[model samples]
Each structure stands twice: as C-alpha cells, then as structure tokens.
Target: MKILVVDDDPNILELVSIQLNQAGYTVQKATNGFQAMELLEEELPDLAIVDVMMPGMDGYTLTRKIRAYADIPVLLLTAKGELEDKEKGFLAGSDDYVVKPFEPKELLYRINAILRRYDKAVDVFIQAGPLKINRQSYEVSVGKKVLLLPLKEFELLSVLASKVNTVFTRDMLIERIWGYDYEGDEQTLNVHIKRVRGKLENLTGEVTIATVRGVGYKLEVASI
Candidate 1:
C-alpha cells in the first residue's frame, strides 16, 4: 500500500515515514499541505496522513479538497484530543484521527482498519470458472484442492483472475502489485508469473495463464 504523510514538523514527518516504511508500505512525505496537493496531482495515494495544523492550507481544508477529488481514506494527525476536534476532523472528511502523543502501534492499527474497511466495501472474493480467490484471506482454490502460493504469486493470480480474460501488461501488473516505486524490472514480473503458472498447472487444465507475445498476460479458463 502507498501512504502520503503531510506535516510541517520535519521530525514528526520523518518519524512517521520511517515507521510506515518499516511496516512494508510505500511512504511519501510532504512538508506542508501545498506540497501534498502538488503530489496528489502527480499520483493518488492509497491513503493519506495529514496533520490538522499546517501553514497555508490547514488539514481540514486539505481533507475537504482531497474528498472533492478522490475517495481515498484520510487519517488526521494532530495534538487536539477533544471531542469537538475529532468531530470536526470527521466532518472535514477524515476516515480516522490520531492525537500527537498517540502510540505508534495504535496508529498502525487504525491505518489497517481503514484499509480493511475499504477492501471489504469493495468485493473481496473473485471467481473464475472452477478457480476461487479470496482476497481477504489470501486463499486460492481450484475445485476441492487448496493451492498454496507465495505472497507475490498469490497477488499476481488475484489480479489476473479479477479480470478473467482481460490482458494485463507487464507494466500494469508491476504497478498494481509492486506499487509505482517498484525497483524491479520486467524480468522480476516474469519470474513471479512463471511461479504462478507452475502452481496453476496443478489444477488439471481448469485454468491457464496465456502470454500475448509482445503484449502481456491473461487468465484463460477451459470450458467445462
């Protein structure tokens, strides 16, 4: 997942960035709301962490602006712990709020909760012929046989199965699975695809991953 952290205090920003990065999320930092807006124009983050107090555009204004454009979740970070402050944060469009003296583990838990809620709001289960994929549980099964797959392999299969026969380019797969900041090359994606194909082969011709020469790959299901 990708997260954008906006704060005028460099120390807090760095601290949050480090913690999030260590937790396996792609983190982007902005010193203030203006910089956050600029970054938003370039790319939309999966979630945003905005401090309630800033120089030019305050966190509330920033949250409102963000809601106007995207449906991504926003988490407000500030020292205000009063009921009215939290109410205002929610009114301004924040999905969650955390006080400055908040525990790091609590902040992480809130982030995960927001993400889980969003994922559940959308359909988490995908079905393609005899193949079934459960995104929330990270489970893949063909008929009665449960397939064990590595994390990357499971994600790759999920993406392809989500859209049946729709061809997904290598770039699309990498961007969706590895994020925009993925440092790996096409060869890396190829390796994961190969591994997924190996596992799918155990399904006895029920599913197949078809490569489209110079294009990309698509999930093909044999007619029962």
Candidate 2:
C-alpha cells in the first residue's frame, strides 16, 4: 500500500516516512498541502497522514478537499490534542487522529486499523465456481490451494470473472485492462488471455475461459 505524508517540518516528514517505509508501505512525502495535492493528482495513495499546522492549506482544509473527490482515508497527525481539535479533524473527514509525540507502534496500529476498515468497506471478491479472486491482495484461490498470476494475467481473469457467461469484446477488454492510451494491438490481449487460461486450468475444472469466435471471451462456470 502507498501512503502520503504531508508536514511542514522536515524532521517529522522524515520520521513518518521511515516508519511507514519500514512497515512495508510505499511512502510519498510532501512539505505542504499544495505539494501533497500535486502528488495526489499524479497518483492517489491508499492513505494520507497530514500535519494540521502547515503554513498554507492546513490539515483540516486538505482533508476536506481530499474527501470531496477521493475516497482515500486521511489521518490527522498534529500537536493539537484538545477535544475540539479532534472533533474538527473528524468533521473534515479524517478517518483517524494521531497527536505528535506518539509512539511509532501506535501510529502503525492506527494505520492498519483504518486500512482494514476501508478494505472491508470497498473490497469486492469475485467467485466463479471453485475459484475465488481477492481484489485487494490479487490472489486467486481454489479450494485450499492458492494461485498467483502475473499482474496482467490476474487482471484479465478478474475482468472476466466479474461477469461470468458474459462475453467481453476484445476492444472492451483492452480498454478496461490496458488504458485507452495503450499503444499495443489485439495481440497483447490474446497473449494475456492465453496465460490466464493456462493458469486456471491447473485448478478445478469447475471454471473455464471461453473464447467467442469473431468477438471476445467470457468466464464459464460448470454450475452456471
């Protein structure tokens, strides 16, 4: 998971970045809310940690702006520990609040808790026959066995599994999996489909990928 850390203090930014990095998370740093918003526009992070005392674009304002469009969770990290400050942070759409001088373990714990809540709220799993695809972890499982595929292959299977027995056109798949800016041709989609098919075959025969001649592909389940 990626986390954005925004603080005017260089020391706090470095400290928070180190803590998040050591906890197996990718960290993006920003000295102020403007820089953070720029980074957000480039690529949204899973969560954001913002300090409330920045010169311009305070934490509360940034949290409100982020909440207006993105669903990314925000955690206010600041020196203000008063009750009113906590209430204001919550009102600004922050998922949690952490005061300064906090223990590293506590910060990590809160981050994990917020992420867990978000995952449970939005993560969707696709189940086709005996196969289960976990969107969050990108793990495909059948029975008690686990199968991992390359990113593209897994995404292909995921798209097909989303609507079993429904054929998706080659162009649709390409546009959905590879963005519209993709410069590749139909050959790329075919290659990914072939790889996904090979991997699915190793699992139970309950699910299969079917190619619709002159069109695209679909996921077929024996029970359906």
Q: How close to the true structure is residue 26 of candidate 1, measured as C-alpha lDDT?
A: 81
Report how far off residue 56 is in candidate 1 (Å).
0.8
For model 1, what is the error of residue 107's alpha carbon versus the real structure, in angstroms, after optimal superposition? 1.1
- In order, the Cα lDDT scores of the candidates are 0.85, 0.85
| Per-residue lDDT of 21 in model 2 | 71
lDDT of 2 by residue, 1-224 (tens): 68999999999999999987766568999999999999999999989999999998999999998888699999999898999999999999999999988998778777767865675567579888888999889899998989988888887888788767877667557756775556989999988888888878887788889989987888999974
Write down the TM-score of every candidate.
Answer: 0.62, 0.60
Question: How many steric overlaps are in each model, in order?
Answer: 0, 0
| Residue 120 Cα positional deviation in candidate 1, in Å, after optimal superposition | 0.8
Q: What value does the lDDT take at residue 214 in candidate 1?
A: 82
TM match of model 2 to true structure: 0.60
The sequence of per-residue lDDT tens digits that candidate 1 reaches over residues 100-170 is: 88877677777767865675566589898899988878888877888878888887888788667777667
lDDT of 2: 0.85
Off by over 4 Å in 1: 123-201, 204-224
